[model samples]
Target: MQFIINGETVEVAADIRTSLLDLLRNYLGFTGTKKGCDQGACGACTVLVDGERINSCLALAVQYQHRNITTVEGLARNGSLHPLQQAFIDHDGFQCGYCTPGQLCSAIGMASEIERNIPSVVTKDLSATSVMLDETEFRERMSGNLCRCGAYNGIVEAISEATVPAAAAKTAGRASP
Candidate 1:
């Protein structure tokens, strides 16, 4: 099967039944996306499938053929860390760092959702094109990814900080010179 993983095109032979998580860690050797639970309950196996966060443990590798996959490894560009990665570091978003990769990927997808004005359960006005992401919105949206070390405070803080710049960039088009 062929896959575009982290901006690289690679082909590998694997069982059709193989889950994406297994294909990535076992076959392709990208171990950043953790395997907390084989089931989809835990978000440790989360990866962005065509820019949307999905639990890799629950998705078959064959199902993602020809689609873009963004693992934690792809977040950085030109040797510079993604804003969320830097925010995570600045806010101490991880304790053991096991869940950090999934958290970061999820945050990336979440930021995109916000930028597109997607509504969440906490969104007050559905008619509004853009919903401001406050603390409640962040917590509710991020409730899926679990952190056993209880780094919720830092995680929220980091995502909040990262989203501000993202929102600004979305509205302003580009950084001011």
Candidate 2:
């Protein structure tokens, strides 16, 4: 089957039952997307499919044929780290680093959701067109992804720093100043 991965189009031969995680890690050698629980309970196998995050371990490769897939390796550009990646390093958001990939991808996807004003369970004002990036929103959005090293504080800080600029800019545009 053909797949567009990290902006590259490639063809691979695999069984119909192969999970997207296995196809990416074992067949295509994109090992950055870790396989933690193999079950959907753990977000370690998270990856972006068309700018939305999904647990790759629970998705069949055939289902994603011809779809755009972004693994952790794709988060960088021109040899520079993605903003979230840099924030992760700057804030020491990881310890063992096994869950870093999923965290990064999930955070990015969460930012997109925020930009689109998609309300989460913690969002207090669902009718508001603009969503604020607050502690409650961040925690609820990132609850799917876990860090066994207990680096939650740093992870929250990094994601907040990386995503707050966009929210600030949007808010500033409506200011009276």
Candidate 3:
């Protein structure tokens, strides 16, 4: 089957039943997307499928044919880190680093959700004038991605920092690592 992953189109000679996670790590050699529980419960295999976060382990490779897939590796450009990646680093959002890839990818998608005005379960008012990025909201949105090392505080902080408005970010200055 053919897949567009990280902006590259490639054909893989694998079984039709192969999971996208296996296709990426086993066939395509993109190990950044981890395999934690091998089930959809763990968000370690999260990836952006058409700009929406999905558990790759639960998706069949054949299902993603011609779909745009963004792995954690795709977030960088020209050797510079994406703001979220830099925020992860600056805020120490990782411990063992096994789950960092999924966390980063999910955070990217989470920011998109906020920008699109998608409300989570914790959203108090769907018709609220603005979306507020608070600790409660961050925790509710990121609950799927587990960090066994318990670096959730840092992860929340990183997402908070990365999601700041561009104008605010420009004036606030980058956080120190």
Clashes of each: 0, 0, 0
Error of 3 at 38 (Å): 1.2
Runs in model 3 deviating more than 4 A are 164-177
lDDT of 1: 0.85
Q: Estimate each model's TM-score.
A: 0.90, 0.93, 0.89
Kindly indicate the candidate among 2 and 3 with the higher lDDT: 2
Question: Could you tell me which 10 consecutive residues in candidate 1 have the lowest summed lDDT?
Answer: 168-177
RMSD of 1: 4.0
Give a tens-digit lDDT track for model 1, residues 112-161.
88788888888877997676666567777788899999998888879778
TM-score of 1: 0.90
**lDDT of candidate 2 over 1-177, digit per residue (tens):** 999999999999999999999999999999999999999876999999999999999999999999999999999999999999999999999999999999999988888887788889988788887876666676888899989999988898898788656544554333210
lDDT of all predictions: 0.85, 0.88, 0.84
* TM-score, candidate number 2: 0.93
Worst 10 residues of 3 by lDDT: 167-176
